[model samples]
Target: MPVPAPTLAAPGESTTPVLAAATDVTKSFGRAKALNGLSLSINAGEAVGLLGPNGAGKSTLISLLCGLRRPDAGSVEMFGRNPLDPKSRLQLGITPQATSVPQTLKLRETVDFVAAHYPEPTPTAELLVRFGLADMADKQCGALSGGQQRRLLVALALVGRPRLVVLDEPTTGLDVDARETLWQQLRDYRSQGGTLLITSHYLEEIQALASRVVVVDRGTVIADGSVDDIRSHVAISKVTLEARCRRRPSTLGRTRSARPLRAPERPPWSPRTPTRRCAGWSATASNSAASKSTPPPSRKPSWHSPAIRKPPRP
Candidate 1:
């Protein structure tokens, strides 16, 4: 399937203006460079997936976007204001990779405590019900399961009713059911025109929630597009072969096939060799005694061993 093209507008210019932007961002810790000239702009009402392997500077970028940490170079803006400014963060929410709620506080109390800081906040009861935490509302935070706590943490981020939300591995330790529930909640948020910037290692999580995907590798944005475009961009051809053992005549070595199983249609000009099939054979010496033998041929040669020979189709 083809991916739709992106609609772009400068910050605060169009009807749906850019809600957040990181321009030429650079950050370093000690001797390690976490981010290098990274730039990303997110518009209103969009769910963008930030994907990368470990040590890709994804977490660092998130911190800069949320104003938790300033960039070493360049600048970031939230709602057209500097991210470091309190006014810029008034409409922002974030769920960090790890969070610790007061052990003595009940779930409702914790929600209320967080809600008190915002001018307009979602009601604690309604928020708890939306996050499937109504039953545990009166339970102490320390008594909740890891999955339940994770759900509450995400719920807390939304309690302030921020226009833009950043979730860093929100479902990291969640079970399949809980993860799906959270995905549904995120989808519901998007339906109401809320923007999301999420970083996750799970490709399925990104596929389920993001309309756009940004692939980062070695602190660089390598690919950016819809799911199909990213998939097609990274797709490659693979060859499969069957190799036969020389010593163990009856025992065959079954190697795993190559990846990306999808194959394109044969070109019109290509000729088909209907009878040809792949066969592999490796030479081995059984004796430790040195034998006066010549080196193998330098050119590619055909395989002639009987062990690797297959009978012709009848």
Candidate 2:
């Protein structure tokens, strides 16, 4: 039997779903395998994480989800409607990779700007305060701090009062607090029955906020399930630490990688460490790597710092 998800029964449309359903979606950019065959199902009130590594074709998936591009093969449907249809556009929220909100526009202007897209949007005041941007409401999105920009983008996503929201690296440059704040916001959105398809690199973010995670590698759906279930598929480790004036990483909790037994090199699998520490430290497998093929990470975190103090659970 094909993977089964809810399908709405309506006249002239025996094949439609309340959320989204794609089958054998494939896209190719020359020789690069952008999407071999990817499929995902998102339901109302659900928060599903879309995960992958560099060149994993995640951006392509987002583009297809938003109706920005046509797949070379397969089908996509949203809420008993097609994404490319103008009618379905308003029912969805999208935060793309491009520095989404325009500059020159004050934060308030941006909010109001997006509000214009809908006949009735949520109150601007509520979105501003919910994202801790009341003070910066008059500032241009271009001038706002990275975290602030991300927050405002999220606010825009909530404007349409959409039934489905797709966030691409939503917390891309946010501080731990800001990221955690958004995490809570997502949970609240889920509680209100808004569905979400989130693409992120933060493993813990998916673990904490996503109801289910679908791991994609090279355009293929390699793994999909709850956090525990996915984590159990790969060999990884966890390390704990307190606030530190000075810290060092330890070998105690480093991962026991199944050498050469690659598992997509996907999310929930951070790189290995060199040595150890007590006051403050993390663990991981360590080996010299020099492929000269892949570029360095966009951001390099300091291990000598404090643990990302997550907001107390809701």
| Highest-scoring model, TM-score | 1
> Candidate 1 — number of clashing residue pairs?
0
Q: Stretches of candidate 2 above 4 Å error?
A: 1-18, 236-314
In candidate 1, stretches whose alpha carbon ends up further than 4 angstroms from where it belongs are 1-15, 237-314
Q: Per-residue lDDT of 225-301 in model 2, one digit per residue for the tens?
A: 76545554432212222211124233212322222212223223233211112111111111102112221221112
Specify the poorest-scoring 10-residue window by lDDT in model 1: 279-288
Q: What are the RMSDs of all candidates, in order?
A: 15.6, 11.2
**What does candidate 1's lDDT look like per residue over 155-198, in tens digits?**
98898899899999999878767876788788777777788889
What does candidate 2 score on TM?
0.71
